[model samples]
Target: MQDVPRIIKAASLRHLTLGLAALLVLAITLALPAGPAAADPGDVEAASRGVVRVVIIGEEGDQPVPISHGTGFAVSPTRIVTNAHVVSEATQDDTLRIGIVPPEGKGGAFARVIAISPRNDLALLEIAKGALRLPPLALAGGNGANLGEVAAVGYPMNVDLAQGLDMADIFSAQPPVKSRGFLSGERPSRQFDTILHTAPIARGNSGGPLLDPCGRVIGVNSFSADSSGGDGEFYFAVSLRELLPFLRSNGVEPTTNTLPCRSIDELNAEERQRLEAEQSQARERMAQRSEEMREVRDKARLTAQMQVLAARENRMALALIALIAAIGAGYAASVWRGDAARTTQARLAAAASAAALVIAGLLWITRPGLAEIEDRVAAALAEAEGGPAPEPTSPSTAAEGDLICTLVPDRSRVTAARTDDVALEWSADGCVNGRTQYGLGKGGEWIRVFAAQEDSAVAVNTYDPATRTLRTDRYLLGAEALAEAREARAAYTPPSCGVSDAARTLGEQQSALIAKLPDRPNERLVYSCTAKAAAR
Candidate 1:
């Protein structure tokens, strides 16, 4: 391992520990070797020959960006396998470019994507015919490759002479840079269908093959262990057996080959500087937002304090007023003497006391207003903090109105007849629409009585209990048209029950009569009705 920064090294160690623990448990339970077996230098070198560096190029928001870089191995003389996400956005004709720099500094051939499987993030590319000397690595068998086997492979980010070479254009690419790590664990059954282990891979290392000690390909180096940074410390790979099915599905067979090895150092100084700048800017922006939030919170606290002070002042004022009134009453009672003088003084004292009591009572009742003030302050604070307000009761309307009718029982029955409907009479004020009305149903579901008009009074048809019918000398409007009828009646005055008092009395009587109606499911019965005009 090359000397790297402590932070990077620490992060690498942490990842190694975690990866090894998971790998060890999986190996022991599955009866695989706990560590990767060491591979021969020649065999490792041979396997590295097929490893190829993968470069992805595409347009990002009008500018061409090299969005992804990874490694791949030639499965056949003409076919290379790489990670699916590497060339996802590229079209078939978008230039499936591949490059290989031999150990002796020779260029290799380019290729194009033939098939891709994003579900597993694997893609197969087709190179030009008869381009390379190396064959694809041989895939290991079932019962799978041994765990802890030494896997040697090179990745794009690994330090190598190829770093100086125009990697952008290389044919017989140098063998993949080599890194050795033991198979940490078996791959999950659901995804790869082959075993996996912890090996150090990097960003530029993806799609590289994971080769066993004997130069047999067991897995493809697809992902890395360093999730935080581009340090080629620990790695993950897609198993070769898993790759085979996908390759076979697309009608291609992987071949065995030994490629040359190249060493590439990790990120250069310029890349490190750029990454640091970005991270610093992000931290500054976060700090600024935090300060803004603190300021807003301070403003809310100040507002709440002001409201609390005001409420305290109001409470003090009320208390002082009560105290003064009590002192005045005592002084008045003590100074007066004689019958008339004493009586007058007593009355004055009593009046003062009564007034004070009334004031105190008002203050006590309105103490909730102070509480409400606090609540309002709290609500404002809550709103500042982005919370919902409490629900409040409906407000009352102060419009003047008149009662339209009154229903009275016959002299004998205090409780109005359950079956009988009292007559409805209405009186209208002189206004365009000023008639008081009363509904006679038990639950206040009103039965229309009289229309609003200028009339003094109008009688509804008599309700007959036997037929359950109302007989009227005059036509009464239906409930739907009651509003218009009431407007019209406001202008007319009927002689008998036109007065406001008479209407109110009649409305009360009708309400009483309706209250006596027998309770029945879904039954609505009207006992009495009245209409009166609005108050002046």
Candidate 2:
């Protein structure tokens, strides 16, 4: 029994020792302070306390709409920072409200806008007096926090749940919305000055602070993932450090200090009127410049049309002169043939020939004018119809003419139903009726026959003449042959035989024909027939 009491005492001592050790540990932990336990590494609560939610409502069409909802943070005790787009819908007349929620039991507070920077999409708001006393977040320094470690905080989609206090409401009716991601890289140069990589942000997250691990404001969440099917979970933010200078320039200080109260009604009316006048002036100047540009374009179109008309008129005058000269030459030739007195006839013939020469000279001069007029008219018509003008084809480039000839029995003729591929043969000198050595036939053969003269010619159709009937070995010439034959027949007579006027007209016609043909590898002399040969 005595040993039991001793054992109890021993057990009590052991309990006391254990208690002392535990008390010592407790004292040390208490002495260490509450900050380290509560704060994340490299994070300070003072930097995150100012973060807030921004809400905007304005008139869209006929109804009041929730134009925007985004995040913002207090940089000073009275001033908050957010994206300009967030409050853009709120006009000077519309109500611009901001909600500031702090951690713990600190209830939400409201604020009004002080100034907005539209170019950078940022705004500064002044918290109303008697509002919640919120801690301010510090803007990170120029060495801007390293790229890979940043945290974004905003009400996000769970804002509705945060608005009303019901744990059941948050769990049952609302989705649990908490997302986190790391920064991927530093933004490229100022073209895209500040960009951050985090889990894709939601519509409500723009203007939210992208906090560094230390809880310092590094960037402001801006855009979310693009719909381009790339890595869609990426988001971007504007660096807070870069935005500080801009805010200061606009008369807002960046320190965590609040200003005394002043309501919107306190501002003088004169300043408001001046701002409105300046905006109106800027708009008027833009409208005037746009009108001037339109006038200049109209003038250029009119000038082009006038140039085309002038060229057409010049060609028409030449063709008319050629036609009149041809008629005069024919009349002079008939007068000379009717005079029969030997001596008087010779004199009359000479006078008639001189008249003809004058007519021919006129015709020669006008022939080119006539053809040019025709071409110009065709071109103008094409232009008016919006069709491409036909290019003048040189004789050398002319499509092969149709073959025309008398095929002896047992001989062949070539025919082309379509003009493109068939070949035409005539005298080597290009005279249509001159003798031909051989002719192209319809079935793609060459037919040869004896001729009265080496220059005697014949024509035959070279490919398909018609669908069912093949005109192989048959000679038939169409319009192409008739034109060539007429020109050749005219060339056979000497220019000196008729009245001078007639000779002149004929010479002009020949010159015009030569001009129409393309240059060839071989030169050919014009044909001539003596007066005796025609009489015989």
Candidate 3:
């Protein structure tokens, strides 16, 4: 019994603490001043995602070792741009291999030097687009890095030197070293378009991108003219005027964003300010409505008091007059009692006086009170819609943000299918003449996506390896829907068998629950795909 009381006391204390904490948080939230706030976007970090460390592998003393290396950035999903010299060593012989160290992972993917512009020291490298899909670096326009503005971006070199690292450390992982400086001037260049900037870089930084404040690549770092010994102070980069032409000629089209980049921090601050201002405005409106209600309520109360007081005074005055009349009638009745006609007249007068007194008494008792008027006023205010009700929060139909995907072939699940289902028509360059492939691993199961020969229909196959069960669902959609579904996610609720309603794709069972789609495959075709790359 004692322990029970102690436990109850402790629980009460905990609840009190929780209530206080919640109130404190609410107060803080309300105290924030209305100001500018916006969404924060990490553009610098996003740009760096496309930047990769290029390594040219060659023989050193008969053993294959890293020959030279530079930086390269993705202009498209499959294409990368770097300095011509970066892939020059690989061009000499088939033995030289070029590999890329992407920003995220430990290992790398191999790239083939696709195009070269020796005149401008720029080259484009092609990679297996299926292996990696990084956000392309947005290119700046003709009005590139401005004078006296800060230039900053990822670079290599000067790091190992500063760290006192030896040659063997070259193969080790190297993250991009960020450096910033002013754009001194554009050198008087006749060879090709160039930008002269004081952005700090090193020997291996030959092909690294020079970025503006919003993380847009304004120029490609090329060469440095030495005036003071060792490393130079004057560094020049290939400007967009020259670089854009090279990209166009090489069939490399990079995406560009025209809106000036805004710092994420500034955006977030702006958003917070806007939210606070909205809350403050709502509070002020409520306060104004309350003040108006108070004024109306006070006026009604005064009016009700005056009306009731007048009714009470009238009732009292009528009752006194009635009383005087009754007394006069009684005296007259006594005087007139001597004669029959006078007595009859006296009786009628007495009866009339009695009726008047009764009426006055009833009026006094039933008169409306001040409290009743106030109650009516309060009820009327309650019934009135004080102000416009706040809009209800909208319910989301689909998941927010983007359902970004890296489409690739289901290598593991392909083995489970019959050989006839998926003919191995993969070429050396990872393309098939008549088929397309895309799939994703989900819930420890493989979901294969297939496109028909005419590209008129698309199908999804979910396979259960453990049970060797294959479930195929097909849909015939317009080109836009098909293309959108491939790059993004499209899902529907799966049919349930004594289960909860959850969203899913094709499964073993198909019934009334599943939508009846049109123009599908004849028999689902036991869904499988040829793992061949498609050129986007």
- Least accurate 10 contiguous residues by lDDT in model 3: 410-419
| Clashes found in each candidate (C-alpha, N, C closer than 3 A) | 91, 34, 11
Per-model TM values vs. the true structure? 0.38, 0.34, 0.53
At residue 108, candidate 1 shows an lDDT of 54
lDDT of 2 by residue, 453-534 (tens): 2121222212222211112221111224334644654554433322334323444434433333323201111111112223
Each prediction's whole-model lDDT (CA): 0.50, 0.45, 0.56
Error of 2 at 215 (Å): 0.9
- Name the top TM-score candidate: 3
Q: Model 3, which residues run further than 4 Å from truth?
A: 1-46, 59-63, 89-95, 129-135, 140-144, 148-169, 186-188, 229-232, 244-255, 259-265, 268-298, 311-362, 376-536
Model 3: residue 442 alpha-carbon error in angstroms:
31
lDDT of 3 by residue, 181-210 (tens): 656555446578877766776666767788
Candidate 1 C-alpha lDDT tens digits along 1-536: 12223212221211233345454454464675354335655556545556666655444466433334566776665578877766654554353333443333355555678898867768888876666443455665433444556564655543533466432333334446777766655655445543445555554666677776656677766654443433224456676556878899999855432321111111124336756897899899889867876676677557766766676668668966886896788667656634574888777886787788677667655553435545665565566656876575321111122322232222111100123433332222211123434333343222334422422122332332221223222222222233344554454443332454543344444543233322211111223322233311
Report RMSD for candidate 3.
23.8
